[model samples]
Target: MTTLIAEDLLLLLLDDVKGTPTSSYLDVALGGALLLELALAEAVHVRERTSVWSSAKVDVAPGAVVSDPVLADALGRVAERERAASDLVTRLGKGTRDALTARLAERGVLRREDDRVLGLFPRTRWPEADGRHEDEIRARLTAVLVQGLDPDPRTGALVALLHAVGAAPSAVDRGGVPARDVRRRAKEVAEGTWAAKAVRDAITASTAAMSAVMAATTAAAAAGS
Candidate 1:
């Protein structure tokens, strides 16, 4: 079974049968997942002892051979210099969703079909090919959010990602996990050590930054309207 965080995040973003993402939020969320994966793998990180989170230096762990082309590319860019978590999130998020979708399709979890936008511009659609694996993933999240069970590091990270992207409600709806419980338990997971302290700190800072950007955008749109 492909147990990469990216794979799991992709599964959650996509429908079990349709294989389509629940929303555009999946894009940035998956980018956060990628950075978390690097943190978990000790491949990249933000510096410690920085008074400000935004100005903290982001660096790749020395000598890590990231196998995924997408990851490798990200590492190369992130390694170039230090940047704020929000800045890195914006930079790292580019291309992550499509890369993960391709990876999932390669694993047979989904299949890509040629299509067109409005029956005009060329497009591609990913439909679910297999669901058992994703079902297992959902079951674990169910256990955590509904059963009040302690999640393993991987599951914990997934819980954090789902909540980070505002998908927690839908993710737990099938099992009827309460929104309150989802928020409470998801906090525990996010606070838990799914990775090194440095990595965990990075995830927290990055997600917060992303949320702020979303809020500001919404406020700006409201004002404009």
Candidate 2:
């Protein structure tokens, strides 16, 4: 009998990517989520049917398969979320796409886009080539998290805000540091560590800048109206 771990399932989903900058982060996340859910369901099914499997440990009977309704339902839910995320990525603009491609390019994946078609392209070609840029962006973001970059509250905060507003995962990861520890070190940076202080200050400044931009946009619209 084969045993599977959570990390094993994660790898299976990540493996589906073609190693191109254009892979879909949404798909990756969704797939990973589904795989984890399914693994859980399988574990439960096995536990519940322990007696039957044990009685026929060595018996390979035809049509002796047991259906797991729980896993099936979970899979369906994941599929719906995946579809929604996919739709979101498909609607990104050229600027977002370029930003994503640039991030992948930093990691040695160069994507090129033709003005005649989608107007941009990443170096590596994958399924739904135009959409792969977002995937690459997502990959880069996850890489930052894995590397412990502490992108939040400043860089990570901005990235998170962008993510909230529909920025692709790749762009956020590439452009922002990881946000895990930004808050924890805020006071330390303000009182002592120059590096930490600098990061905190930068985040504050960027946030202010974004807020100003939004305010101006809103004011302009109000005045025009």
What does the lDDT come to for candidate 1? 0.74
lDDT of each: 0.74, 0.32
Best by lDDT: 1
TM-scores for candidates 1 onward, in order: 0.86, 0.27
| Each model's Cα RMSD | 2.5, 22.2
Which portions of model 2 show Cα errors greater than 4 Å?
1-137, 140-195
Off by over 4 Å in 1: 52-55, 193-195, 223-225
Question: Candidate 2, residues 1-225: lDDT per residue as tens digits?
Answer: 111221122222232334333323333322222232233333211111145223101111223222433334434443343222222222221133333334434444343333323556434332222334345444544544444344423224323333322332324333354343433232222223223333333223323333334456568889999
Note the residue pairs that clash in candidate 1.
Answer: none
How many steric overlaps are in each model, in order?
A: 0, 21
Cα deviation of 127 in candidate 2 (Å)? 13
